[model samples]
Target: MLENIREKSQGVTAKVILGLVILTFAFAGIGSYTNSVDTSVAQVNDMKITQSDFDKAYQNQRNRMAQQFGEMFDTLSADANYMANFRSSVLENLINEKLIDFATAELAIRVSDERIKQTIREMPEFQVDGKFDNNRYLALINQAGFYQTSDFRDYLRVEMTRRQLNQALIASEFSLPYEEAQLTGLQNQKRDIRFAQISAEQFKASVEVTEQDINDYYQNNQNRFQNQEKVKVNYIALSVDDIADKVEVTAADLEQYYQQNIAKYQQNEQKRFSHILIEIGDDEAAAKAQITDILTKANSGEDFAVLAEEFSADTFSGENGGDLEWIEPGVMDDAFDEAAFALSSVGSISDVVQTDFGFHIIKLTELKPEQIKDFAEVKDEIQQLVSTQKAEDKFFELQQEMARLSFEFPDSLEDAAGAVGGKVQTSDWLTRFGNTAPFDNAKVLDAAFSDIVVKERLNSDIIEVNDSLALVLRTNEYQAANTKPLAEVSEQIKTMLIAEKATEKAQNIAQELLTAFKAGEDVTAQLAAVNASFEVKNDIARFGAELDNNIAKEAFKLPHPVEGTLSASTVTMNNGDLALLEVSAVKEGEPATNSNFAQQHSQQLAQATYKSFIDALRDQAKITRREVVQSSEQF
Candidate 1:
């Protein structure tokens, strides 16, 4: 029965189930199927975490960080402290996952194979045109480095089981009604406020700066006005694009390359099939019986598309008259793939197929045979490919020769360029932070400015700008760092001093107003004495947008006003102005009774409880970390 089911299942779905089942049992503490036992990184209870697993996980994490950080990723990755911290984090997470897996096994937590099937079917990555395409699913899994469908399925199964256990734990948490109400009220509280601004511009005209202040500032901060070191270089560049036109591809080469890579020219056979699926959940027997009856009707000459439209449970395809479009082998569950492919010809009806998705009645509607393009049809494409290959080979050969010639004659790039049949290039003077091409590369800039290249007048070693491109440079001119004379920057310093004095004057005036207001003196009357107009705002919620956002944020931070009294505070706006805020009334928000609020509150509470549960599990587990293993360069 199991063999029959396997034979009728879709290839992708079958492999998914197989992989997940393997992972499920592996995590359930079945130790008999261990891949490696000798080289363990850490041990949780009796289960050993292998060195291979740690290396793979660490490499994957580093790749992700490199992609996210771009050029800076290399700098961080090379830091000993950062790499140490990252390794520790990866190990801790691995330990935590193992503990969770152990807990699930102890509590008998299990995820059904049917659930795994549904997840794979619904994954957007595997879908084309809003429906699961078996060919697309197979292609993605293969491209992702999963040689066997079972391997990818194993990963998914482990994740699903962990999620199932976590959800079960979350469901056990409960939040009290009073607690929810209090949180709701706090989140929605509002304040009624009034404020007056103390503008820096009001005092700017009164502030003054002397020549003495400018001279003093320039004298004390000489380092701030220095010229950066600069260098100009004579270099030789070797790139694939430069060599492409010179590298010739003959007709014989194109034919030979096409014959060598024949598989690349062939298309996979495909078939179009319609199916009516009876999804199996808890009541598998009932679902099976329903699918059996449907198959009987289908074999009895009933219109399959009509039956599928009326009875299929796959909502994505059922509405389209059960049309799955074109499918290739290994794209679907193994059973389904086998049964569909085994059908003798177009318009043939398949047997009732059983897979993780449940049962299906399949009818093959169209068959597309595989085809390979002849040399004549793909000659241009083959010629381009051969040319690129030849150009890349020439570039590497010239790069090596340039490196050797540059080292042999350290004084000039003339020898290197002549030896490699390339031209010598020169750049204008560029500073350390130069944004020009070639000098923009950090490695090239560092090498160009180094003492060996600049002072010793030696040719720098060949630097790889990227794959298929390299550079060798010698510094032709150099500029040493020097401080600028104070006279050149004295005016700039005088303007900065004036702005500083104006801001200080404004802050001092605002402080006096705050102190007077706290001492029962009327701040509004005081502002009127200075001919300043105060702005008044009302009914400001914690998140209100109309008021100056800085003032609103500070107003919310202040303590609520006492009964029949106001709370006063000062806030500095972004534009160098200060505001003296007088919050006259505080209104407590009413607790929300809406369904959205309740649902969100429940989710937050459950997450908190789940975290606590995981923490408890960690604290209770007997975790043993092996001796620290230094990260290998291989990763």
Candidate 2:
């Protein structure tokens, strides 16, 4: 899902980014590129993944990588390397996305505005501490390069469409037992091995080292010292959160605002509706007869659910006793929606109403009265609005004071402290690229390397590193280029010794256990003594499982479990846990009975159809052509 989001965000064009989709591409030239427009980077059915889309995706990818890796990434690759890799990855992803979109359009998958609102509300990035933060939410969208909510909503729409279509496709693409077996059979394979390890300590004695060697290595890596220009800018900012506490809104004002926007407080009428629907065939006469029969039964005051079961074609709703939940306007077919809403009281039944779905006889089960909430009932909302404004005003006042003091006394950090009454946090020397001491944010580190701090030895500007706070800095002194002597790092060498020894001990134990197992010794006793449970994940299928590592793939490649220990293997998990497994039992996919077969076949067929529909679109879209430059620069 994260990868899917990455792909969609990548394909966002300059126009699309600024085109009103919030949180997409930025209007500023964050990572723009110039290329010819041939309209053939990818094809989705009849649609195109235009050059603009690829460039945007590529640009966003680069920005994200730069933000993530920072200085460390500078030495990893050149511009060409980045571009080549980005092109291949983005092209494949965009192709898949466009295909799914085409399928979704054909299928007419839709998402409700309520659902989008809910998604936004649930996003953790938009939250502060533990509650939703509107300021944080807005800031993130702006940083992402989107201009407004509507644009983000459109991006969300495309995303939902892709998901729904993929789901539908998965349901349609039924894989038979034979196909499932072809994948699952691989998991039945097994192998045999005996292995051992050599630790880093083992090679420590053989390692060559000298004082000159250290000096040479350090001198050769001057690019590491080629400092990037970082700056701290003095600025004044206004935000609602800062002055919110200072603003005092009166009850009279709140009342007036409520009166002006009464619709916000007014309770909308809701309908508890039930309908007996008679589905129509293409033949008008047949539909009319079905509608007529339902209307007659309803008029006779027959139990609605009973009449629905006897005459309605909406099997799903009919089985539920013809109950439809409370609905507002615009929720149902226009004809049915109008008739349902027109009801003035409970127990009222509508005349047979014609719609695209044929005819519906609606019963008004209940009516909710409209009411305007009093000011006291919504005081908290008003308080939040007024307080937020006050907070913004107060925050910017402090910011302006800080900026002014910093400009007047450029070399003194305390000048700003006196002006804004904000505490001045000074620290010892910090590295140019590395974040340590007082600098923990990007803005702080950037300021440490600026011309004013390094050359002129002056204080920084009011730097808003993030949304909530801003800071100013003055470099007290400079540290010349130097490396710590080996004598000072001797204790560090001892710590490395302990780490290498522990790893060697673990590997030695593993090897000894593997040997014992080969001799038919009980392995459980050894593991039990170590307090580790030996897990045997049994009869695992190859596909449709959420396993990202090569382990699952390697597991399938092994032959069916035998009485012997399998290959001596080592996999270092992300968290540093390593595992060695012996295959004990294995099973493969096989055909089921007719009833099960039918159900599975139907599901797979649906999914495949959906996937095919999407793939066709991607294969035909208006994509631009270019020699995909494989480089990390295109990130």
TM-score of each candidate? 0.64, 0.51
lDDT of 2 by residue, 1-635 (tens): 32243346546574476566443335534344333435556655466666668778876765677689985444332333654565687787777776566656767788987577557767898766765555566669888777786788788878877777566557545556665455434434332321222233433454445556545544564444344334332323333454454467777766676677778777677668788887667787787777777777777887877787677777765786777756656446678878988888887888888897777888888787877888888878866765665466567777888787776666566767766645565464455444442354546666666766667666666777555566677666665555555555544554554555555565666667667766777777776554444554554556535442445555555566555445434443333334444545555444333555556656767856865665666456655445653222222
Model 2 residue runs over 4 Å out of place are 1-96, 99-266, 289-293, 296-300, 372-385, 396-421, 427-467, 470-635
Q: Local distance difference test, per candidate?
A: 0.81, 0.61
lDDT of 1 by residue, 413-531 (tens): 89899988888888889775524565666678778888778888788999987786789998888988988877788877877888888888878888899898888886777787555
Best by TM-score: 1
Model 2 lowest lDDT segment of ten: 190-199
User: For each candidate, how many residue pairs have backbone atoms clashing (under 3 Å)?
Assistant: 21, 86
